[model samples]
Target: MPQPVPPSWKDLGKSASDLLQKDYPIHGTSLEVKTLTPSNVTFKVAGTRDSKSNVIAGDIEGKYVDFKNGLTVTQAWTTTNLLRTQVELENQIAKGLKLDLATTLNPEKSTKAAILTAIYKQPSLHTRATVDLFKGPTFTADAVVGHDGFLVGAEASYDVQAGSITRYAGAVGFSAPEYAVTLHGLNLSTFSASYYHKVSKDVEAGAKAIYDTKSTTRGVALEVGAKAYLDNAAFVKAKINNAGVLVLGYTQALRPGVKAAFGLALDTTKLNDSAASTAAHKVGASFTFNS
Candidate 1:
């Protein structure tokens, strides 16, 4: 009998993933209270120095709306982000939708909620890109008494996703330690909170907590991060988790409507009981333009 083994395990995909952006979300509307009704689009091309490699470029087309008060609404048609980056070409064509809402209750208090869902166009060997939705509510307060800025917020979500695993149903069957395996379920939750305070006019620090639970396991990672403005040309920041994982990042403003940012992080993961620990060091950079 021929033993089962992974076929065609190439580093083509692995090498391309290393040089992508860490934080793709654009930031600037943090404390602004104006109606920002506009349609935005962006593209990012990432690749290594290898001439034989293809640069993976992604495009995000979305619309953002902010009311005169503190109410905010955003709708997006994102090609791929967290879930879509893993699979092959057929899976890459999958599509998703996101809706978000944020409002201010008082001069120093606020609330927010969001819903996101995505599904694949076709089933691949690994997964069919199952449907997943996240819905949660949060409350926040900031700058209560003589503080430059302060905030405390919490939220939770119930999510469902297609199992990223597959099994062959034949006499030989898929090679596994067990005959029957748990496929997929809709019972998962994630909770998170953060509090930010400004120490000076050009620097700020914050603490955050993120707790995630799946059908099989649960874990939490705590983080501390800071941002500094080094004049108008350069800035740097750093962060780390309780598990000794580290993240260092920086962004530089270039010209009037163009800027770039980069980040690096280290983490580990275990796929199954028999699987060995996989260590990954990731780096990403992004450029943006606005008129």
Candidate 2:
């Protein structure tokens, strides 16, 4: 009996959560362009704006991969306080093992941080550990074990300076060809459950519910979503939450390497209110090109 486990405990409910949250929408307009060069380098540029007139944020990034040494290097510059630079390196240590090192530096603020992470995996087990080299020398670790389509996992983090545990969580899940479900307890105070189902070749649906044990209001937050494939070139998604918030998204391929996405979010409870601005409604669009 072979059961595949998630990379980390945090991914226990990733499938259902992604279905309900991912590709839903953004709050502003954004565009991304990328190209791969013959020299084995990839370059990307992305920009975002609150309105159609001016660009509010943007970044340019480059990445190179060394297949022989199993290493990848990435560098990025973003518009923040003149500019911010981020560098990352990932290397495969051995079979089923890898290490990732990343750093972010802000010259204007004179601030920088570094992090290191290691990942290991086997047929029925997976584990990951991370450390913040400068801040608290914090330590975070997680592991998952699976057997016969069932999985269990746990994760915890500790801050060396605080001399205490910062957070802890656990999860259990079952995966099948047609459906998957997961239940998790987060930080010993919050609980969540999720389910994903594939109805047919072209339709999929998912739902998630979360509850806070510390909340006086015993209400659970629930969200349900579905994705419908219209054709090979286009798709549509819709989701609604317990707060009467409805979201819709559509993505279409304009050509071989170009795609566009449009998203809208509305508050049904605010529809009857006399005063409603952009607060009650939000819309955004995104375009992507890969060459």
Candidate 3:
């Protein structure tokens, strides 16, 4: 019988234990290394124009990475950043300055109208640069100088449901948040310095003052307005464009990265000393895409 085969099993156990002990440290270190991923990294790529609309409109750019520890990188290409085009800028000016002749004045398809026709169509022939400056704050001086289109202050109108007429005096003023600056205490046609501020994320409040050179008709007005984002895809705004009317608008994000903006504007204009007022409502819309 014999205590005989206590078995070589003891030798097998010892070998197994030795192997486990030797590998334990290595296995733990491997796990720790996996957790401590490298951090320093960088990536770059080019982008193309966004063409969500019939016309291409913007540029794109993209990137992501860390640069602290080792090089662990991530990156993305970006879209081109396209700004408003000359045509788009001209459209904005037209929308802002356009008069509704179909209703305000009699519609005519003829080659003859009046000072009004020239007033309405003058922008079309003007260079793109002139068109861009039409309603902009920076151009009142130039407008007064007659280097381009007329300024808002230059034309005073009196419109009513009965009739309306506008007297072109060629005036200009710098519109600002608290106050406006005029060229001369007399020449309301030129503004020296203009400043404006946002009252809220969607609201703006401001004022403007103009001096009359030929007459003692210096005047000033207080203004208030709002811009509302209806949704991630839509928005509406109501702002005062001039003394007589308000501007109301709606904009929709039509597609992924694409948008359309449209507005119905009401302008109050004076035609004569009668102090009559009229309505000139216009609807304008444009589409834009950002890649």
Candidate 4:
């Protein structure tokens, strides 16, 4: 039998988090437009405006991917007149090993770089390590072990100059075709439980609860979300948090190569409060075109 590689430690609870957060409606007024060319280059412009319709903030970014050389380059300019660039190179070193190097540059700030190495040793063992060089080098590593449908993983980051561990976390999860569950902990203070279920071919549902032992509040923070595919080219998603914050989004393919999305966010508790009505709702839209 072929050895099936397991997910990285960072992605242990990704399924649930993605359902609850990713592609969800944007909060506040904003618009984003993106265009992708056939030559593997993407151009994007996005911004939000104030009540007077004056552009308040935004950025323009362009990215190009060179598959023939295993390289990707991204550059962006912000409304603040800051220029930033990122370069990434990736390659497979062996059957189950891969190397990735990435660098970030900002003339206004500082430059940073990191090298990541991943190894899939067997059907049950997978490991990833990253070394960030610059502004106090740090070493971070994580490993995931799987047995049957169960998985356990831990991650830690060490500061070389300080000779100390900055962060540590662990997670355990079980995966099935229809459902998955994960429990995670960070530094023995913050804990989270996430569950994802595939309700049907067209629908997905997920929920997550977070509890901080050091939190002054005694209750857990909860979020529940779901996604439903209306057809091949349209989908809708909604999520709500414990604090009565609700988010809803709908995406549709406007044409063969164009897509549009509309999003809304609302605070249910403030709907009838005149003093807080002004901040009770947000809306945004996005469009994408790909060749």
Residue 136, candidate 3: alpha-carbon lDDT: 23
TM-score of 3: 0.30
Ranking by TM-score: 2, 4, 1, 3
Candidate models: Cα lDDT each: 0.35, 0.84, 0.32, 0.81
Q: If the candidates were sorted by their lDDT against the true structure, best first, what order would they fall in?
A: 2, 4, 1, 3
lDDT of each residue in 1-291, candidate 2, tens digit only: 554645467677777888887675557888999999997789999988975345689889898877777777888888884343333333454677878888888888888888888888788898999999889989999999988878889999999999999989899888877889998998889999999998997999999999999989988999999999999999999999999999999999999999999999989999877588456878899999999
Per-residue alpha-carbon lDDT of model 1 for 133-238, expressed as tens digits? 2221212111101111111111123232432222211111111221111111112354444445556768766666556675254666677666678997877777
For all predicted structures, in order, the TM-scores are 0.38, 0.93, 0.30, 0.85
The C-alpha stretches of model 2 lying farther than 4 A from their native spots are 1-5, 51-55, 81-92
> Among these predicted structures, which one has the highest TM-score?
2
**Mind sharing the TM-score for model 1?**
0.38
lDDT (C-alpha) at residue 235 in model 3:
58
Candidates 2 and 4 compared: the better one by lDDT is 2
Cα RMSD (angstroms) for every candidate in the order listed: 21.0, 2.3, 32.0, 3.1
Error of 3 at 98 (Å): 35
Q: Which stretches of candidate 4 lie over 4 Å from their true place?
A: 28-69, 73-92, 109-122
